[model samples]
Target: MSILVTGATGTVGSLVVQRLAQQGAEVKALVRTPAKAALPAGVTAVPGDLTDVASLRRALTSVRTLFLLNAVVPDELTQALVMLNLARDAGVQGIVYLSVIHADLYSNVPHFTGKHSVERMIERFELPATVLRPAYFMQNDLQARGAIEGHGVYPMPLGSAGVAMIDVRDIADIAASELLRRHWAADPLPRLTLDLAGPDALTAASVAALWSEALQREVRPAGDDLESFEQQWAHFAPGWMAYDMRLMMAAIQQHGMKPAEGSVQRLETLLGRPLRRYRDMVRESGQLKLG
Candidate 1:
């Protein structure tokens, strides 16, 4: 089975490509630049831009399964729709969409709304798809490693409230399974929607404690004001991204990031093992920084 992975050079998409290739699958990485794809051996890097439907036609050629991960761009919805149309036309059998957790609940966020819009299109088109709503990535904390190591503080906007953040590794494994697993019966399995998270529901304070233990330093918990956070983030990122993230963080602050009961266990079942906790992520952060 020939599988094509979009956003192949990204955090989650790259891992999916590696997992599929390691499983002995015929993998095609649909990236904008094949020379810079940096994919594993045996994985074919096919140059293609999702924004250009014509380019997608060449990449989707003979691709039976597709792993779709739309970047957080202003034209995300348009790009996703174009890819969906091309995939449908190319006779791609299955699609595994990498979507944000709580996208349905927090549809007001622009990026989440964009993903939801594409999801609606996928359902409306009656495509064979599996939607993976993965929680906030543990890798996001790496951005604040400097603060943890130097300033000795955790500075996320999330307050004392707990969120069920997950590891990208788990997301990649589950996505690969959904994309490559074959059905036993003649009838194809129904389209599935999974809410994925880590083993523990962690708060900002708890995260600080983990960092302190891992780094053997006093990493204090520092609550962030949303307004300041947005202002600071906007300076570095796009205005819309800062605004969208601000709104999402506000929602999380108001309504805690706690997952539904049994959600963790269900995710573990799909992962085929226990999910990684914040401490585990902290322990691995040092290695991640070097990479």
Candidate 2:
């Protein structure tokens, strides 16, 4: 069974594509630009957009399984809904959806709500699926290296509550495994949801301390000045995306992306290893600039 990976050019999607290819799975990547997709040698790049029905229809040809990882955008839900309907029409046997942790709990956040809506569609349509709810990507902190290394500060609004940030590599591995499991099963498997989290529940202070130890200097939290976060993103991202991020941060402030009981044990058992740690991620990523 061939697998169709939506958002295959994105951060986690791209990683999943690589893992699937390494496992010798037949992989098809749905991307806007086939010419520029730069996929693995055996992976086929199918030119398509989530909003374009005709394009998606063509991409779904002969695809038995789907990996849906929609980006955060103004029309995210519309894109996901259209893709799900098309996947059903094409007789997609199974789906692996990448949704946010605490998606339902963070009700007011647009992106979180959008993902929850996708999950509902998967359930309502009775699609055989595995939903992966991952916390904040630890690699996203790499983007703040300049702030941490140069200015001695952790710029993200991690708040007093702690988040168990997961590694993208682990997520990709689990996604690939699930895709193959669904593809190989003779009988239709029941729906499952997994909360992907790291080994430690880290707060702003803890994150700052890690940076301090890494860089061999004093580092402080930027505090939860959400307006500044919004302002910073507004300059780079579209207005709606920026506002959506602010809402996410606000929700994080009130309720951390804490995983359910045995979440760590479950992930560790699946991988046969301990979940990746924030300190290890920082060290391995070469974030430390020796003074």
Candidate 3:
């Protein structure tokens, strides 16, 4: 009766592992290198990769619940399909998949399309799973610390449609809760999707203003220039991945990442607490000295 977490060394995956451990769940982390994976003391680290079938089979053995997370790689869809197929064969009781918000709407983006396809497969095959479609991760802004701190600018072209930027910490909390629910349930759970979003639907201009208020310095949005944003990120990420993200930004511009009606309230009711705000997380993250 153990829960297995893939991408255990990664951002959200790592946080989810910590959360499950704090809740005292029997957690197993699937990592490439178990010796090097810096997981909690009691959490078991299993060596496996999505592409390696034998390793995955070994990892899935005796595990009742799974947190399926895959990075935005070239073989993302392939990896997800393979893992899902394997999960089915292994009779894994419950699965929690980390998907993007508006995955069905943003069909142009590679990762989004992959997730949409995965969602359909889950439904078509009737996998006992919960898909968590999270909004723009507020921590993504942390990467722009150089721009915000060094220059007085927020460079992301989050567009005018407004994104309800969600906090990663809250995502982990909800993910762990779902994992625990599925783990402890006597019967198998049905397929469900949760739209994880923040309280405020923030615009680029408003985000700049929030930074200004928090840092006590004038911070400005770099404007919704998709090409420049892509070019700038191209230097850091793969060229195709950067372009993929630019397309995603365009979709966000056209169709905001706002949650469905009462999704935020539903999430709040589930957690028995308000969803974390973008502004408050910034202050607590210790990324910047609050003014």
Candidate 4:
């Protein structure tokens, strides 16, 4: 049974495809532009758009499982619901969803709201589903690479809040395992909500310190004020995205995005191994540079 992966070119989805291909699973990747998809060898590339039901239906033929991640769009909920309906019609056996942390509690954030809506739809479907809610990704640090190098600073809206940040690769690894596992049939694949994180939690300051140590350069954590950060982002980002980012940052500050106790156990049980920690990612990526 082949596995179909949506968002096949994205950060987490791309890694999921790679891991599945490495495991010898028949992997089919759905991409809007097949030419741009750099999927690994032994994987099928199907040209499709998630918003188009016909394309999705065509991609779902003979696919047993699906890895679902919505594209960044205003109509994400509508597109996801349409895709879920088509998957059900095509007899897809299981679904693994990559969603944001605390999506249910943050309706003010449009992206989280979209994800929550999709999760609710998945719960109501006959198709077994597992939802993986991963905390803030380390990849977000890459967005500030230039600034870090130029000004010795990392500007994030996350204030004094400590978050259990995870690497996208770790998230992908867990997802690929779930998609390839055959043990779900006996238990019917519980509608699980997995909270994924690195081995430890770190505040913005602590993250900068790690980067500094890794790169042997002094790095400063900037943007202690939310309004200033929001205004700066709004100058370049779309209104909706800027607003959502601000709200998400605020939620992180107020509630702290750290994983709950036993989160690491859940991750370990799912992968049958310990999760990768932040330091491992720093060493592997070699993106951290010190002043």
Alpha-carbon lDDT of model 3: 0.92
In the range 122-168, model 1's lDDT, one tens digit per residue, is 78987888888887889998998888898998878787667889888
| lDDT of every model, 2 decimals | 0.82, 0.90, 0.92, 0.82
| Candidate 4 lDDT over residue span 156-190, tens digit each | 85667678888898899888888876323644476
Worst 10 residues of 1 by lDDT: 181-190
lDDT of 3 by residue, 129-183 (tens): 9999999999999899889878999998987898999999889999999999999
User: Model 3, poorest ten-residue lDDT window?
Assistant: 282-291
lDDT of 4 at 148: 70
Which digits, one per residue and each the tens of the lDDT, describe model 2 over residues 110-141?
99999999899889978899999999999999
TM-scores for all predictions: 0.93, 0.97, 0.98, 0.92
Best by lDDT, which number? Answer: 3
| Best candidate according to TM-score | 3
**With candidate 4 superimposed using the best TM-score fit, by how many Å does residue 181's alpha carbon deviate from the native?**
1.7
Off by over 4 Å in 2: 287-291
